[model samples]
Target chain A: MAKRDTPMLDELLKGPYPSFVKELYKVQERKPMVQDLLGQLEDSYEERIGHWKHGGIVGVMGYGGGVIGRYSDLQEKYPAVAHFHTMRINQPAAWFYTSDALRTLADIWEKHGSGLTNMHGSTGDIVLLGCKTDDLEPCFADLTAAGFDLGGSGSCMRTPSCCLGKARCEWACYDTMKLCYEFTQEFQDELHRPAFPYKFKFKFSGCPNDCVASIARADMSLIGTWKDEIQVDQAAVADYAKGGMDIVSDVVMNCPSKCIKYNGNGIEIDDHECVHCMHCINAMPKALAPGKERGATILLGSKAPIMEGALLSSVLVPFIDLNDEDEIEDLKELIGNIWDFWDEHGRNRERVGELIQRVGMATFLDGIGLDPEPEMVSAPRDNPYIFFQDEEEEEDDE
Target chain B: MGTPSIPEIAEEMFQMVSESMGKKNLKAGDLTKAIRQKYPEVDRKTCKLALRELMDNGRCVYAYFGGSYIQLPHKEGAAND
Candidate 1:
């Protein structure tokens, strides 16, 4: 086939500002619609203003989720991609894609919408960039046939996601992939419907290193950790020391808690003071390893902040065994309780963090039937200062 | 008119955004600032609601450049019929 002539983008080839556009075509597979899409990019430019405007409600049937509605400025000028509906396809755990699956997705997208994709969007879904209202059904059907379903797009739960835990990492304290898949499967209703005040996102990280940055991204975040002492290889430590390793400077001194010490030949770590950070293990892989007592810490209220400022998720449930059976059941129960409380009380567009700020932490804990823990509060109230505030005034605010 | 209704206030804000952001796309802050300056009586929440309304109707799109900029819907289509 001759090089797909991207007439729409031809002009950008020579212009001073065309370097980015020219660079896109550098890839061999960057042809056809990707080329065409990029070509039409300048059509939306300030100079080449599109004329169409958004007006009516456009969506697919039966499903109240997945589709994000938007439109073109001038339908006649860019008729090929005038109507651009973004679809969020629920991704596999860690976005694992078989060659066949990717081929299937690309085939479906090519037939129904622009083959352009956002790869994996920040929400951890395979974001199909552009679609028409007419093709949504066919596209959706084909994707579902390929064993792919649409992810949460409306005010319900966003797709549950996790880092590549046991699938490809040694520091994983639990099967993050399995848990993410389970959460996606189990919480279909939350993922498909706009039940809560706003969207909820669940993300998991294998360890406190937080490869996926779950602490800053997810509303409900889980980071794997251990509660016991880090297993030590005394012989390995001695070898490293013997090999002229700076055990005192690197391992002992760098221990955040000052719990590690070198006694000339080997290293010793105070188990009680260990915060379960993977720092020591990372520094000396052969000499140290994660402890045996593995579990996960659940954090809450992380978001980028539209209503309130950006907030990192705070530890809610400090340690929960992430093993199978009892762990899943307990997790489900806790999740349910949390959702129920939020559904009943959360205001429109009020994220969990904002809700907690609006209603006191005491109320949230009481509503969820959870006892107050030291990790629950955003900041410590250790000032030993007490102020009497009338309950009546506070009630009016919530 | 004695204080415009929410929808009316929203429409006014949208018009201002369209006028202010002629060819150049705009951040919510810039548009919000322009709207507030023009319609000082209109509150922030009302302004946001209007922008959201435009977004839902497909009239507005977020150009993901520097933080999210709301531009007149240029690409992407949906059935908001």
Candidate 2:
């Protein structure tokens, strides 16, 4: 009897991109494992025909949430592929890729992939979109041998990434790169395991400008900040003013707490009123700078669209002394506790933010022993009655 | 192009139907409506082909709920309409 042909290959080749199937054709040149991936890919294609053709989910059992690997069949007949599997690679400390490393990665990709890349995914990883399951292990091994590694997916802890801080930026309040590296090493187990309730992302910023958008996209947003007085040099202020610095309109107006004031000769900052949003420092870099006591402000519960639209993470640890190992460990313990608590209690598809919303924030605070503060509230505006002081007694006209 | 097989399209349609249903059953016309939401690139004809394939394979059957029409997969050993 003739082999049962499913016509799967015909339909898949009709897609806008057919390169994944094309890649399988080069089975001779591909690594032996790639052949396995090809076979699995075909099997996956067969299985996906009924579901993916229309639109449905296909995920592994052990993992919580992942893009169900979808494929357009067409491989049994036509061998040429126009697309391949893609992965989102998380960059190192500051993404300072060595020239040699860059060349090697490009070469590896050129050899194996379609070479199209989405420079950065919303969460800040280099997303490479076409590879096979068999290629996964070996590709990771190759990348690792050449000083690269697979980033987190599914329920694993994603790569802890950071922005360029002291290395070249003038506004760096803390050593973001070092801290990112340290966290990467410290949370290796979390980074590799697929046992969490859902995926967790960590992003660090050098200052409040949030180049990496940690506030809007990560579960843990570490933004560089300080509690000490702003370093205001009158001479520098004068120089910046001479160089056409709009101190009043630019810096003072933008200050979150109106902490800055321009008095003809110089800019004055009321330290007690500064919320350290970094607006003044960013606007007048030379005139105003951060204090010597550099640390990080840690926020939690942000994400890119799961339970709801994107959320802006809220401050968890107002200030953490990153210089001390014990302090770092404190943060680790907090993270571990939250992860453990969430892992045991979180629904399969829910994120930490979702869980927090489901269970009252008060309960989460109690579980973690975190003191509830006004800043900890998901929406400060949600409780108008609490913050309403009724205009401070209205002068008590008797 | 070769005529797509019933089972092939059924499997893909089942998933698409499930995603479109999203914890709710929708009418046959609603499948095209929902399909367009997810794959704006594909035309209503392609979606109908998918639906036809699904129905042929017994993955979905029509019924009435809340005084409106809706389509759902025939659950294994389910009572007949």
Candidate 3:
């Protein structure tokens, strides 16, 4: 955008409050519209008295979703961007977009919106920000005509996102794209309807690497992993050793559990002691690979702060065989149970993480009808890491 | 015609919106017009409330424009997941 005559913004540029808008404008790859909006807001600082009111129900056509309500307090002053709503177009699985498709999306948005877009947010929605109320239908029409639909907003299930798993990554233990797409289709009502106490997020990672950081962000997390021992290729190991790679110092010694032994021929792993950190595999990729047995580990209650502090999702199910026919069904049933329990007991605006915190893990476990395993205990109070069965040992000692 | 209850009018309005649009979006004004034929005694305020209830219950969406519009959200003609 040709620098508009923003007298008020110029004045604020000299202010002490860090001048974030100016700083943003200084960025090399900034979108001009965003800078323009910031400039507009700065120009009419006095006219904009307060924040715009939101959270009232708003949407369009046969669906109970798509449109997000937005407005500017300075509607009278800035008529062009008065009721600037946000439209969340559902991003493709792993955001695989061709250049032509991307250009089409940009063209459509420019036609309907103020040309302000957030490529993708943490929730994985292709967010088209700064849209007018009247342009909702036309914008949606153009978008849908071009084969795009909206994702969830409001108190409903937010968009389900996943990492690039089977598409490109060899470390992927399961098909993240299939599961992500299947679940998105399967849970349409959840995606659209604002029935729950608060928004729910589902993010999937192909493996423990958690490139998407779903463990700390998603309300529910699915991580791919192998159930069996790590596979060690003896030939590759010998090749690495011959190629000036120090197996004893690098792989064996650096093992978190020290379960790896460099037998001078091949490395031996104490299967039970392996932590699945992927460190050895990453360091010596040619020599080691994930085991054949593959599935996912379900982690629950991950969230960012609203009521409580941010938390990583705790392991709910250590190993779920995603390959099994009944496993997906079981997973769905588990999700349903969790939702039911949360719906019945969750306070308004409280996320699933906050709900679990308010009611304790035992209650959550019972609510889902899952028998609490020792694996579920993220932290232990006393010693005896190995022989942890029940409270009987503590009682006996007492 | 006698006045219809909020829930009755809301349900009917919801149905009208669904049938009227099929997959397309329905303006809130359209529902008001249709609802008036059946329940002439209902005013815009009450109709709006009923509409709000429907929207909240996931029957419809607000359409998120400067003004209120109700539409039955559908999953058609969109990109594949």
Candidate 4:
């Protein structure tokens, strides 16, 4: 009696694309290794046994913090069809994996673990899930041997993730990748040790567009910004208008600050009033451009799924000059100071965002020696839809 | 789409809702506001239904023993014991 396998298959076939079960089918036949594993997995399912289990303290020798593997004590009763967990490979200052790397990763997963992967886990590691506990040791050996390692988890500072800022995006105001890499290296000890009150995540984006959703995700968020001018191409704006673009209604009239104006001639921007919200730049991609004097604005206190819902990581440092190495060191020191404070006072599973919220943002600023500014609040709600005092003046006459 | 089995948190939550004497019992709207703050991921209506379950389970006592504005009763002798 070929045990009950089709029910599980049927259940898997019922919903959604990018299904791991469907992906498993791609290698089910061609790969002898996978076929063998699937056969064993089917047996466990027939007995209604669990395929995944847990294990003990395992890391590479000499490296206090390499791969951490887990195994199930009940492997005899519940045979695992696959290994599950994550790996934290060292990312380049701005990781740009070659096609070969992608292929190698896929091949390795097909051989030793589940073929499924999250492009990059929230922890900033190339997360490979579903590897067995026993396979963890060998997998770690192979990975580290091939030059990879585990990311921080369990009270340690997790891997710092960042956007490919200036490397690819024109909106990049600063070198985000460098800061992310430098922070990871600088805080390696903190990354490996689980001594803090809760987890901390740092994410950097090249621009305010926040490709990484850092504002809503990371404990510390770095977004690129400028205190300089907005470069407007008059020729481009004129061309857009010529191309049947309504500059008045679309660009000038819709300017959040009424910062841009068109009077039958060309366009003008009142630079002081521009909030650098990226709306105009996004609206007229060709006409407007970001300024050259690039710097990063640092924010803290963003987390999801706990306490007061999703809080937008608010800006702390409006601008930090990223032009020099010394500046980077200064930023690292500041980060270190914050971690030390949080580690000492944070409760278990409490993220830095939660701690900051509890301790009050004012205390956090005092600890870091940062002065509070009005911009520390959410960027001024710029939508002109609401009738303000000035608008009421106009309404009175009407 | 399949109708989700109302979350257990729904009934589990009414135990926490404080009922003022003169106020209307927990309406779907008020329950939604309270539970949404703590457990925003779950459906508000489901949470209300969970409150209903708690009422059925005898774990929670409601206003007038029937209306909304429910409260989880202290376990017998457990508080002092």
Index of the highest-lDDT prediction: 3
Q: What are the RMSDs of all candidates, in order? A: 10.7, 16.0, 9.9, 16.3
Q: Candidate 2's residue-wise lDDT over A7-30, tens digit each?
A: 554466567885545544454244
Candidate 3 displacement at residue A370 in angstroms: 1.7
Q: Rank the candidates by DockQ, best first.
A: 3, 1, 2, 4
Tens-place lDDT per residue, model 3, A25-52, is 5531344435546645665585665445
**What is the docking quality class of candidate 4?**
incorrect
Off by over 4 Å in 1: A1-40, A43-57, A242-245, A377-398, B1-81
The per-model DockQ list reads 0.05, 0.02, 0.07, 0.01
Total backbone collisions for each predicted model = 15, 25, 14, 16
The complex in candidate 3 yields a DockQ of 0.07
Query: On lDDT, who's better, 1 or 3?
Result: 3
How does model 4 score on DockQ?
0.01
Winner by TM-score between candidate 3 and candidate 2: 3
A281-398 per-residue lDDT for model 4 (tens digits): 8888898888878888888888888635777676677688886788777887787678656745565466777777788777776676666665675433423221234456689989
| Runs in model 2 lying further than 4 Å from the true structure | A1-70, A73-79, A373-398, B1-81
The 10-residue segment with the lowest total lDDT in model 4 chain A: A55-64
Error in Å for residue A36 of model 4 = 10
Span of ten consecutive residues with least summed lDDT in model 1 chain B: B72-81
Models sorted by TM-score, best on top: 3, 1, 4, 2
What are the runs in model 3 whose C-alpha is more than 4 Å off?
A1-3, A6-36, A41-54, A62-64, A379-398, B1-81
3 against 4, candidate with superior DockQ: 3
Candidate 4: residue A279 lDDT (0-100)? 81
